[model samples]
Target: MFEKQQVIYLAGGCFWGVEAFISRLKGVNSTEVGYANGNDLAPTYEKVCSGKTGHAETVKATYNPKIIALDEILESFFKIIDPHTRNRQGPDIGTQYRTGIYWQEASQRDTVIKFLRKKQKESSERIVVEAHEISNFYPAEEYHQKYLEKNPQGYCHVDLNLIDDEEFDHLTKEEYEITQLSLTETPFSGKYDDFFEDGVYVDVVNGEVLFSSDDKFDSRCGWPAFSKPISEDAITKHRDFSHGTTRIEVRSAKANSHLGHLFHDGPGGSPRYCINSATLRFIPKQEFDKLQKDKY
Candidate 1:
């Protein structure tokens, strides 16, 4: 397999928060805080913070596209920054904290522009995020690198909890409504309702390993039926009384995504997890050989 690595510079308010958030992704090899799109050759934090250097505090990330695509990375950045607001992000309001996407490669421009166009349609307000080629970038001071990692209580606008799942970044409207809003898919109409592929099933939201093909069985149910989870801690069970009925609801611990209601009418009298196909991503054994390690 050909491994591809790409570098992209993004500034979303404070570099500390952006750096911390992006470093947690699956394919990110390294991240460095810097000042980008600036006039100064080697801008420092003091100069950039003054808003006179024409630079924005940014993070340069080297990522493996084979593991996570550029689109996913861009979408994750969007989720944290307010694209409509110009020259600011979170609590930091200045040119230094402005949101921008600086590409190092010409081939990446098309994808970046297309993503912005799609984001524009989804947004009602005009986008203020700057999309341009990187003219100059100067790495920030040594202390600025991984600032959040050094100081856990440091100030940051990006809430680590509110970030969207990179794995399901391009989820369809139906999938989002079902997974995020706890809506149920149509009975027996799901793609994996009767699928019995030999592989592992993971949480669509956070990429956490959830179920295995060995535990999956056809239960004549509308959703994918799993007799058991890969581990007891993989899922959290709660008493769900929604939809005018009482049932056990299962959600992924890492993502808090609603899988489906649990019933005891499964094979061998085991609890059948009638999981929604929209909330679960199945990776068959043949295709999973290369990505056996869990992303989460």
Candidate 2:
């Protein structure tokens, strides 16, 4: 049995707003606005605000995953902030107000990695959200906790109207970085680049498998290239000329992300399915075999 409450640390912008926003979540048992991710000893808010302490205003949330999955919590976190922007959230600009995810367990790290990869593949732009292992977390001054609840009229830079449930379905902060903010590449420098031998590379925004290793090949373009999609109906093509060159864009029929361009040139005059490495998840053939066996 899983624990009734799991803790997650998130830093989007002002601690007041983050705390207020998450407090309204159904599964959230409680929210504490505090400071995490810093190298100072009992740093004060003035020092943190000065951008010298490296402390980010964060919210430590206790929630029940049975009521709200970690993914859903992360999705809501992304919708409220600009993940592509570094060291800033809304009108709050500083390292103390930056966005981040601090993981407490190995499983949590893996979950974040998987979500990041899927998000990159689902967006044309890159993702720039930073993720790090949790270190020492120092709670903020006592007055900071639930500050918004105590003083509803307090000045907050966050847009309360921006909090919506629909956007949470498709993108987390990691997805927003790639899809909306156009921040390319994973923040950890592609540390989790591995083609697993199981599962399928479904669309990050929607569950759709556009390609598999069975169709992947070496185009020698320094990226993963597929000869064709798993199913013809799984992908859609559109005219794109954003780079001063006219080309056909490859997109998932469901989760539309700029997968890369298609070229008429290929081995034996076949069309080449050139795709970005950041935009794909490779499930090994062995995993596919097991899945096939279980389908009966």
Candidate 3:
């Protein structure tokens, strides 16, 4: 049987770096550097660089859907590019350097647009990445093809290591990155934020029980809020001043994976334990005791 393939175009800063970054994905069949969403049918590197061709440096990613989902690809794209910055990514500047996702197929078009809207809710900064129907795309010159692979030391604002498939027990790539890499999920985006099932949440990286259902509360933090950990020994705290503030960073004791942060404000006498949903896996109360004592 012939293999099925899907194509999508992404323009995030420099095409050279963007092309190289995506070329490493698992399902990717091929990637080509190009200029897209411009009026000029014959846009060249020089003409686009002149900032008058109305072109954006773009990367055409062709991949097999049977291996990778469209939503996962879109999430991977969002992880590398800063959606809030307008008309620029990294040090590159001008219209050619702007970040965007252009689509052709109706299914891909809806997927891209839906992903963007979901991503926009996660950040306070305004999303500047454009989502548009495919207008035009001109393949870049041969020398620009796989420029980073040839140069090896070429410039890339993206951290390609973020997507590497590293097993974290039962965690997915996105879950692993969010837990081990300190990457935060969108606020109010976690499954347990408003969930009140009568069970507990355990560290995804390890089966160490962390938070009990009784302690879970609604803080409107968009994450699973707990009044406290199941016990003081269940978690560890470290000094975290990232994003320009001082706070206690929470991590699972057994897994040493980032859970979230501790805040002083809470409804009653307890401090609010704001946690990331990706870092914790939930166990329903009914099955909590049914599991083998050694497994949970």
Candidate 4:
């Protein structure tokens, strides 16, 4: 048996756009637009828009983990809104339009903290997004439920094409690409240089696990470098006698990313794996346990 009902509150820009965007998600059982972090009994749209109430336009979403995970939901949330911006999304400029995550339970706080920390490090910016406990939820009027559905050509910035439900799956396409593909292209450089602190650097394209913390050494090569992968089976090594000397080209069994070349010349008694920073996603030991449990 699986837990079918889980609730999460999101406040991003206008409630109309947020409601419209979240309603289309696959696992979403229901969505209700409301006012949160305010003292009013039943805040009207006009009252909230006044900016004096301190109420943010929020959406309460009910989803199922068998179909979607909280992490996936959070990831999707990140893509839609700019966390770097303060108290605004696009042209809507006000505190009522602020971004926030209202945690329903105490257990979720740690996960939120971890996600926020990783996000802050990746962006290297001050995160203005708020994470707080739910005090009270005042549901908006009936017209606010599916504003976009009611008015197709309404003023909304949410592009539905970017929101893919498949990404919410436990092993997402991004994760699959990392595990199976040899993705060497840096989508955003200087963003994930700190991800090499510890643990193994596996092939981002295939699930072939490679490289370990013990084998990792600071080469100051701008990207992560490992003495050697965990095993030869973890990577498909190819002989490249290009230019002048013969060298080993490291590739993932699942896809191509041109992860840096390997060399026999390395410290200790191990091969050197010079890999690109963008090709890997770090999984700390603490989070690894949660990932394994979620998979089963």
Candidate 5:
């Protein structure tokens, strides 16, 4: 009962973790680890790892548009890898570990470019991700397929369970309830309600940057309020009819955690984001700058 399926090839480091992570997404139909865009007619893992086959360790993700938008998938990919880095991801270093997005459908090219443009604008460093039409791909060895599933303790840079409900195990009880259950914290009781620091607030589950202090303002709404998010696309807004009233619910785009609600009234009539403090973790400016440099 699924809709037409579309595929994208992603090379975001080791294929094992990439496959494990992407395969668990809501709209994904299937995922396979493989060698992609290589010159060798029959490339093997050993050859590709040598960095001579011109192949990137990639995952082929088949997804249904009716279930998950292509833009969502692109966002998820960005969350897992540092697009500003070249020929590496995590601890892996080599051309084979380079990050890229390969599309087969001609219509998807523009969408990918637009996504990259938005991402580029958000960062000061140049994005090194390769986005283009799929040239060629060969399925990886049988042993490499579903490697994490077979070996639960397998080495993986990514948290394979990030998209699952149980993945919020790292969050505190109140944080988990608010983020995973859409339960709002008491407005005036939030940790950040009166705490304004020169830094950015990030998704508690995945550390994806959500809001900056520059956009935050004291709305006196008994909650941590922000004029706007770091980016319009950073959060997704949905119509909420809970409590017998209609409101716009906001959630983290990558983590899909219930962050807060968006209200129309604010300073200068701008939108006000009433976010839960438990659902976020603040990274100070000094530490955030070091993290950025470490990624390079």
Candidate 6:
């Protein structure tokens, strides 16, 4: 039997763009434009625009979790909306334009919080996006539903072209520099430099398992230090000649993304793999097991 469908309410500026972009995702079953989390029981687009309805233009997205996780959806949502800005996105400036994640399930709260925390660390500005249980949701007028599909030239705040740009599209600015441009992050500045959570680190560009916590050790080198990767085939080593020094650089085998470097100086003669946190995504042991179980 197929897994039950999952739903997530997303309010990212105008609902038209949110619906347009979210509906096109691979696992998305459907999307509906709506006014959500409003005090007024009877909500109309006109009332929402007037800033009295307390409703944000939201998109109700239903997707198959087996194909796409909630974190992926949240990550995609961030790409289209400005989380740092309050009550505004692109040209729209109103209370209804505020971005939010209104979830239905309590289980999703932890995931949302974790994702937001990671996003907060990556951003220089305070994130203003709200995460809460949805109070009320009302379907928008029939005319407003799938507005972009009906009117191709409709004004949309989101850049729909980003969906097609797979390479370096999902990566952040620092991640792109570290992975694609082969730039090393500053010492002691990465998120995972001091973090020793029980999890597996995967390539940021692609979800390819690279290292595990079992192989991780405190090298005090101001980077995430690992004794070895999960598998020898998971990574490729290259001779780096940058900065007038010879160093063995580590890169993900699948995406060929620049990870960090390999050093022979480690405890007990084991090679130390100093990796950039920006170039990796850590999945906790429980979550990893759940993901593996969900696959089959």
lDDT of 4 by residue, 96-173 (tens): 999998888787788787888889888868998999887678888777766776687888866666765453344444
Worst lDDT 10-window in candidate 1 = 236-245
- Model 4 alpha-carbon drift over 4 Å, by segment: 1-3, 165-296
- Residue-by-residue lDDT tens digits, candidate 2, 103-149: 87777888787777877787777677778787768888878876865
Q: Give the count of colliding residue pairs in each prediction.
A: 1, 5, 1, 11, 0, 0
TM-score of 4: 0.55
Misplaced by over 4 Å in model 5 are: 164-296
Candidate 1 lDDT (Cα, 0 to 1): 0.81
Pairs in steric clash, model 2: 121-279, 126-183, 126-184, 127-183, 196-284
Write one digit per residue (lDDT tens) for candidate 6, span 1-296: 12266789999998888888887665555577899988999998899999998999999987667667999999888889989999999999999999999899999899998999999999899999999998789888888987886787998888987676466678898897677556678999999999989989999988999999989998999999999999998986765544547888777766767799899899978799999989999999999989999998
lDDT of 6 at 44: 88
Poorest 10 consecutive residues by lDDT, candidate 6: 236-245
Which candidate, 4 or 6, has the higher lDDT? Answer: 6
**Full-model lDDT, candidate 3:** 0.80
Clashes of 4: 11
In candidate 1, how many Å is residue 171 off? 26
Model 2 TM: 0.53
Off by over 4 Å in 6: 1-3, 165-296
